[model samples]
Target: MQRVVSNLCNLLCSHYEITLISCYKANETLPATYNFPTNVKIIYFNEIYPDFKLDSFWDKVKFSYRINQLLPNGSKNILIVNNLLYPFFKKKNTIYIRLFHNSFENAYKKYLYKKPLFPPRIALFDKLIVLSSKELNHWQKLHKNIEVIPNFLPSIPKESSPLQSKIVLSVGRMDKGDQKGFFRLVDIWEIVQKDSRFGEWKLHIVGDGLLKEQIEEKIKAKNLQDSIILKPFTNQIEQEYLQASIYAMTSLFEGLPMVLVESASFGLPQISFDINTGPSDIIENEKSGFLIPDGDLEGYAEKLKALMQNQNLRESMGKRAKEIAQEKFSKEAILLKWQKMFNN
Candidate 1:
């Protein structure tokens, strides 16, 4: 929502009154501050509690009730619901557009290990928007109104440095609490650190996670303390992309990661394990990036080495990546597609 909504505001700032409504109030300032016009109104609907986790029954009930009652009932309100909130209320002539950020079946299987709670609500959605072509295919097997609308990152800053560091970076929620693919990333990183060839290169992880302690333990056990640097989250991730040469991910799955888009915008080619559908769509193997065969740690390590050893290949691919990003994924270009959706 950040990419599309923010870009939408940018595109129609002068013509439309874009109000950004947050379900739960945030204590800290909005991340990556908005450049909204004076016409835009940002407001919070539900009270934010510090201890509310979605897994709790009481929290879920309270949230559902609050959401069901609080949505703006104004005739002009276009209730663009994110995937998780689609099952809750009803609105008429509200342009009930649903944005599916992740693959539904994959996420439900990974998180719930059960079927969706509100199957009927899924059927009632007027339209579904997803980031990758693969996700459109996945959903279209059951629904016809699904559309592909890829997310875009703003252009890299003028002062951003060229891809110079040999460091391989992966950005995602490090919380081992979810059990999604945190361990798999740590395992692959350990394998990458064992070779002396990567001695000159660093494995810098930038994100906070519940599994920080466990991730640290694995690094210490492999005596990769010096080789691997676990840094906390930073709002200025563009700098991380600027210094890094390669973006690596071992996610078991995704809905086309924003980090990969951000990384590629600066010509930092990716090396990711084949997930259910996102990485393969973004990373063109041996062209702009390499997609390691799924669950192949040894192959991932070797691919990383090949990119690291040959600086020319890395630079060439990074340059090609920047071209692809500029031509296909800029916010200005992608915003046109969204405008067309709104028009339809």
Candidate 2:
């Protein structure tokens, strides 16, 4: 979300007066992890609660109400509330847009809709921006005002992968509290390495989260240390894409996996479970990559092995993947949609 926000702000700031409002940031200096345009204004909400959190019900209520007082331009312009879909966070008569970075069904199934008043509170927003059409279909039934505007690609690489590397790259957060469902990778990789033909192949997972240690334990237990390599996140993710032959995503759910699009830009054949909203939107199935039936470990392993065994197939699919990403998810194409929405 930070990367997408940073990218959007950097571009949109040129056309509009963009002010980034961050709730948890304590100091004025923005985090070095993300860059911003010089002209964009930034509002940090931690003047009072420097270490804000919702550990208690009182804290939740406090944070919600106090936020109203701190918000800039209380009664003018558009307000986009991302991830937090609370009625209390909205302003009176302001053009509000709620951005859901996850699928509507899973979000409701998990927690947000369980609040009893939550479902009805969908009416509060003038518009809702979902990451994919899957959520668009589900959300439109409840609220008529919804848009399926995906995240724009941050950058396109000039160099594409040669597809000669024996590496299958996976990148995503695997925090202990995350729903990324990375444990499934362990089971899938275990099955994948059993084939003696691909003993030299490696699954290189590049990400950082609290679950890294626990996942490392599982990898150690399987005694497949030589087959799977875990690396920390890097700023040079495009280099990682260029070095890999295939991209694998086993996300339990996603809004839209930008990583898949990023991987595609570097001409890597992709593999992902047919999860809602994200993967299907970017991947062209057998052409760009393969989509295993959701949660089908056996099926996922089979397709991954097939990609591993054939360099020609990987190159063919990867070429198509790059074409789709370069055409569909271009920054101008996506921002044009936003420009129209804002103008309308």
Write down the TM-score of every candidate: 0.81, 0.87
Best by TM-score: 2
The TM-score, computed over Cα atoms with residue i paired to residue i, of candidate 2 is 0.87
Residue ranges of candidate 2 with Cα displaced over 4 Å: 46-76, 83-93, 110-113
Per candidate, the number of residue pairs that clash is 4, 0
Question: 146 in model 1: Cα distance from truth in Å?
Answer: 1.0
Residue-wise lDDT of candidate 2 within 222-249, one digit each (tens)?
A: 9978888999999898888988999999
Model 1 residue runs over 4 Å out of place are 1-8, 28-36, 46-77, 83-93, 109-117, 158-161, 177-182
Residue by residue across 204-269, what tens digits does model 1's lDDT show?
A: 888887888788887788777887888899988877888888888878778877777778777887
Clashing pairs in 1: 174-209, 175-209, 175-210, 176-211
